[model samples]
Target chain A: MEVVNRYVATRHHVEGAPTEADFEVREETLRWAPDSGEVLVRNLYVSIDPYQLNRMKRSSASHLAVDGVLPGQRITSYAAGEVVASACAEYAAGDVVAGVLGWEEYTLFKPSPGVLMSKVDAGGGFPLSHHMSVLGTSGMTAYAGLFEVCKPVKKGEKVFVSAASGSVGNLVGQFAKLAGCYVVGCAGTTAKVDLLTDKLGFDAAFNYKEEPDLKSALARHFPDGIDICFENVGGEMLEAALANMSVHGRVALSGAIAEYTGEGRRAVPDLLEMIYKRITVRGFFAWDFLPRFAEFGVVVGGWVRDGKVKVVEDVSHGLDSVPAAFAALFRGQNVGKKLVKLA
Target chain B: MEVVNRYVATRHHVEGAPTEADFEVREETLRWAPDSGEVLVRNLYVSIDPYQLNRMKRSSASHLAVDGVLPGQRITSYAAGEVVASACAEYAAGDVVAGVLGWEEYTLFKPSPGVLMSKVDAGGGFPLSHHMSVLGTSGMTAYAGLFEVCKPVKKGEKVFVSAASGSVGNLVGQFAKLAGCYVVGCAGTTAKVDLLTDKLGFDAAFNYKEEPDLKSALARHFPDGIDICFENVGGEMLEAALANMSVHGRVALSGAIAEYTGEGRRAVPDLLEMIYKRITVRGFFAWDFLPRFAEFGVVVGGWVRDGKVKVVEDVSHGLDSVPAAFAALFRGQNVGKKLVKLA
Candidate 1:
């Protein structure tokens, strides 16, 4: 049988601003074989995250310890795929699995140590794409950052979220609403502001682009000051949030999409505000909470199914559009979880 | 008996830059009689701290339930004094007591419930002024921030300290050194830099003011990145520190002298850096460690006596120099613990 394996690859190193020229398409020859503890997967969906931009950079100093894709190596990420071939007793040929799969037509799934890929029930109510977004790392990130670090959200506490329309922020706002907190969020445009207040149930929302003065906008939105700040955009937004944070406030350092492109570095914030307010700013990695994934999946999946937690995904069709789709996250182009469907 | 009290008071609010006009010399009438559970004390020494300047501001939102100092009230602080008249049986007429005493020649010591004051040792090797600086709040601040929050410092771990020659930073460096960590520090000037490397035994020291690029300087000093950061100066220093911090590094947010004054605020740092680095930035108040003081006192006091922990006090003679002395901390003009002598 002739196997036509199509794969997306990076073209060149991305400097200051990433362009379409940064990525390229490549076709690779495929061999269909299964060794012990291996199951071949037919890639269906791939997650495109802002953090992937860091991996595209040539410098290893800034990038996380993931093996970066070279000019011709197939790009890979957390993807949901169907097991087309299998040698491992754990999987059957037609089983649906979720794991690190390549951004290609088909992938050879080797059973690496410490890898977690499980079969999903075909009868589940949620869509398969939900595994790559809300029921995936994005939701886990919001859950870990909010509940684990900034614990015990008391009723009537003011919560401020930056990048409020993004995948994580949208769910964080919904979770805060469930916690009975007065949620206020900031986004880049009026549409995002509307999404936060109207759809996500945020009590107040502001377009950071429209407001020249971020500190004043925060103060106006939260007169009593923010009790918890789900920080995603770093730069000026973090500064304004710190200035307006109340005593004993918690700032969950989830992401900083603004400075990911290595632009003119934003001004450093006043650290004295943290001390004066007794603020707790903690950084968390979702992978660290993998042990709790089953628990998280049960809880978050139920929330999504019950409509208590809303899941928003900005899906781009075709695997060839993955680079632009990932880059869009930094530009605030994606409203929710940005993903690429490789059907 | 003719009783007279000489006190220091704030004459007016400090403007853009504090001047001698901000304070005035005044002599107030004193009563010789002591009410029930009250003691009359002869003021010996008083602490001059950066937080006092915050109290001098027209508006302040301190977490410690402190109100701003009104126009005419006497400046109060943790001071050491000799009891002259006593109505409490626990204290005698000649007992040397230390508590919150005003910047005056004589102070009325009312027995505040739940307040504990140390009985000064007449034959102690350390100077009495050490109570306000090293042996008091400043020392406690360092001990708490370093040992309590940044715990389990494994041998050969890298530790970085900002404002390394200052009161708390000096002690923090020594404690880290004792724990067998490679300690690096940054100070404002060459002299302070020299003090960090030579006097404090820091593995490396740099003048942050002389280094135009803080991130590059940090990379050069801590090539592998810092494991713990004792943050005293905030703003750009904090940003650079965060960038150079190693995975799972703990940033002990003790003080941020960089933003103490009304100077233009620095840019906010990219919060994503914390997530990528998996850092923990915790703000700590010294009073939170009150329960551990007795245990800490025994350990730190022994260290002081054994010459393992060196204490530095920047003493400004006379209470009249208190405001000017405190202003020096914000300007990075003082090398160590800034204090005022009343006797």
Candidate 2:
């Protein structure tokens, strides 16, 4: 049978702060019959990530910057969906799965054996979109990036998070607080700052836009020194964190959305200080910790059920609004898990 | 009775590159009588280190850069000496001791209990000056920085060392070579590069000053990827190393003499690359590994004895030449360990 699929695709290549005009929504028809070892899924929700902006650009560096989605092609992202038809023994009709899928209402995925298609267990009692939010890749990023990479955030250590209102940063702050750490976060707007402190339970929050000097701003908040820095916004913010870090501090280079457009200025650190202070700075990708997802789910799901993790979503409705919501991410307008619902 | 004492003192504060005139040789008389729990030593040698320039600076940063020697006070340095008088019963005349002492010929050390003064066990069959060179702080630095900080240099992995002709770098390259790694190093001069490959047993050596593009120079040498970088001369060399580092690569930042003067332009690294490549860039002080000094002494001592480790020292005679020899360190003119010999 043939089905009409509505999806959003990039209209043209974008540079520097992607706008809604960079995308065009259209309808397409696809004949759906699952091939061998394949499945047909109706995507319930699609994730809008900072990394998507990188995929739309051309570069030859050894960066995680994937090839950009070209004109007339539907973009790819981590998505949560319900399987409509299946040829693979691993999946059946109506099974909920979260993995790589296109930004379309329906997808026919001939996934390689044991890659990108995992049938998520459904007893969590949360909405399916939460799979794309806290229970999915973003949550794994916060879990692995915090516990595995940045030395697990010692109790009573001062922790600092840049872009603390974003999907990954918010969870990092919560996880750190759970570890009994003194947590401070920085955001771009006052409302986001309030969300971090009032709603999110950060020990302190500051609006980076209001602070004229980031170094002093970090110093003012982190008087004892930052024991762990969950670095998301790169450039000047990262440098300020480096300068204010305590002896034997650890910095997890989680993301650099500030320079995803390749147009932002980066901070230069005094490499000498790295030795004198004996700091360990490491950068990692979330997939490195995929094997531990089952291990992560057990702990994080309990937190969610116990109401320890306050889940937030800045989701928009319909396929037509995907571009606008995605654009809002770079503008720092999203409160939490930025997604698009297309049920 | 008073003994005439000669020492070197900073004439004035040095801002950038230290010149010969920034220091002066002066004479003083010390009425030395070992009081209760006090010991006196006749200085034999004084080590000239890059960190001394930091001491000459006027700042209160938590760097190795300490308060510069005031205009009139004799400089403080790590020294090896012969005990001339003792009231502490821990030492007697002719016993050799090495620790942080004065640059003056005689130092009356009322050592607080068990700190700062320790007798050296002789019979290593090396000269007394060797205590200030391969057997002293410099050797410990190379050993600890390589073994402890840079992931212990696995066999056959490609290792690169910057400032490969200097006191610490030379030893690091040798240690990596002994561990059966493909070691490459960068030096400022052709003579130093040749010394690294020929005398120090490096696999390949490049003159960074001769190369127009350090990144390409490193890429040519590291066609596969660099697993470890023993960074000493920071700035552009460090950046090039960072660009070429492989996944999970560990960079041990031992020193940054390039910026010791607080004036040299250092090449700032792209903090984002640390994440993309999963690199661990750490800076550490050699003293952090002091507990392992005995373990280090056993291995490095054997290397020096069996002609496995080549010991080199550039020494100037008399206290009058101390300022000139010490100033030459910033100029990158010294080979191996630089020291001043005082009788």
Q: Who wins the TM-score comparison?
A: 2
lDDT of 1 by residue, A274-295 (tens): 6776777877777777788888
List clash counts for every candidate, in order.
Answer: 3, 7
Number of the top DockQ candidate: 2
Once model 1 is optimally superposed onto the true structure by TM-score, how far is the C-alpha of residue B25 displaced, in angstroms? 2.5
Candidate 2 regions exceeding 4 Å error are A1-7, A26-35, A60-72, A111-114, A152-154, B31-33, B60-68, B112-117
Fnat per model, in the order shown: 0.62, 0.68
Task: Give the per-residue lDDT of model 1 (tens digit) for B183-283.
Answer: 99888899998888888788989988889899999999888988999998777788788888888888998876665665645535555567777788887
Clashing pairs in 2: A55-A68, A275-B283, A283-B275, B55-B66, B55-B67, B55-B68, B56-B68
**In model 1, what is the error at residue B5, expressed in angstroms?**
2.5
Interface Cα RMSD for candidate 1?
2.9
Categorize the docking of model 1. Answer: acceptable
Give Cα-based local distance difference scores for all models: 0.79, 0.83
lDDT of 1: 0.79
